[model samples]
Target: MPSQYRPQLLGWIDDLDKGTNYLSGADDRLLYANDNYCAFLRKTSSDQIFYLCISFICIIGSLFLIPSLIYSLPSCNNKAIYFLLLAGLVCSILILYVMIPELYQNLFTRKGCPIIFNRKTNKVYINESY
Candidate 1:
């Protein structure tokens, strides 16, 4: 028999419109609560600064390395090895550029919290970088 799920690449995701499973975050995730409404943060409890910092460092390092590699290439002792090293750096940089579109927003411009819920309206509003 075929599986009920419409399986997709990378992740197995459910149809958002359907309430598929018994899922809820902990009370500690709550920001505030009252008679009218409540708000909660959906971000993971674990710190993500390290990952973001690493990506940021990669961006900075690539920017600096590419120029210096080019500048020193002509003066290097072994042209063949210099060209090979430059090719490696360029390929790595190309990979980084492909990843930039998503990473840039997360690294620099992600201002809003991950998610928000309102009991009064019985609705969820999401304004997340990811």
Candidate 2:
């Protein structure tokens, strides 16, 4: 049997793989799933997955902006912009907290292999160990 940490870490990796599969396989449906799908589906539901993906993208983008924002803060001389950046950072942190768990659950709750998609090549792979 795997150690506690090993399973948890593997679960996270599986979730990432499953998330990638969802993104590439059913792109349109996942993107435009209606209220029914969002409300009813468990684990890798459209909204949760989409939010997780968006949160990651936003976090990466925010990291790039952090340095510039910090450097310009003093010269900005504008309280509003500073407040906006602070608010954005807080929101991004919150999103990360919410989405990461959901992503992990979505990936590891199932018994089958973790599914991954290569968007560039539009190919799918199943990772059984996960």
Candidate 3:
């Protein structure tokens, strides 16, 4: 293929492998179905995943700290520190028990992917098709 056509040819091949995308294959009805595009259905979905991971760490850390907190309470002789540690443990437990399920529902229960088209600039973007 000519050098100028090489990029377009490669793009076509890539689109074919990707199955369906707004920028390429599968016709109008299937334009919204692409693995890469579908993975990122919501713009903030990735951010939410990151937050969930961080929250998991917080829960684990608090669990491990409970023993240390109890060990320190006698030596430190501070009721406030003990209560604060207890509160942290409770809050972390609440987040795990409550927020984790909610996050799963909100993040994973999306119905379908959406293909976004910009009218003025004629640009296209894909979102979760849920």
Candidate 4:
């Protein structure tokens, strides 16, 4: 029967309240929302848009490389070209499957965990339960 933890419970509640206050009334939320909006608008704020643009460029570049690889097939050695084509195809597929989805989720998804930022304490907390 070691369930008599009143003091611990009170402390936990206090911490929770403080965290809630910080998250609900901080500049960090506005910053996050602003950054997200800028990303959506394809505007410049930080390096996030640049990184995404670079990914897009890579995807397009890989697509173009495929055709170049095909065009050079007649003069190129069979085994080396085949391996290069295979590797390029695999990389393109991975970029489409893994990287794109993750980027989309990070930039778009807003229904899952609520990220809490405490500017007072400079702490960030994620509430995954809600």
Candidate 2: which stretches are off by over 4 Å?
Answer: 1-75, 111-130
Question: lDDT of candidate 4 vs native?
Answer: 0.47
Off by over 4 Å in 4: 1-44, 67-77, 102-114, 117-130
For model 1, how does the per-residue alpha-carbon lDDT over 11-119 read when each residue is reduced to its tens digit?
2112232466422434434555455444454443332455566667777777887787788777779879888878967876885795565355556543325455454
The prediction achieving the highest TM-score against the true structure is: 1
TM-score of each: 0.46, 0.37, 0.35, 0.40
Write the number of the candidate with greater TM-score, choosing between 3 and 4: 4
Q: On TM-score, who's better, 1 or 2? A: 1
Per-residue CA lDDT of model 4 for 28-62, tens digit only, reads 22223321121011122333455566666766776
Which candidate has the highest lDDT of all? Answer: 1
Clash count for each candidate, listed in order shown:
0, 0, 8, 0
Candidate 2, residues 1-130, lDDT tens digits: the string is: 4323212323323454643454333322222222121111123455556755775675566566656656666676678988887776566566556656655654554422234444346555554432
lDDT of each: 0.56, 0.48, 0.49, 0.47
Task: List RMSD in Å for every model shown.
Answer: 11.0, 16.3, 11.0, 12.6
Once fitted onto the true fold, the runs of candidate 1 whose alpha carbons sit more than 4 angstroms away are: 1-28, 44-46, 72-87, 94-112
Clashing pairs in 2: none
Point out where model 3 deviates above 4 Å.
Answer: 1-40, 43-45, 66-76, 102-130
- Angstrom error at residue 31, model 1: 1.6
Ranking by TM-score: 1, 4, 2, 3
CA error at residue 100 for candidate 4, angstroms: 1.9
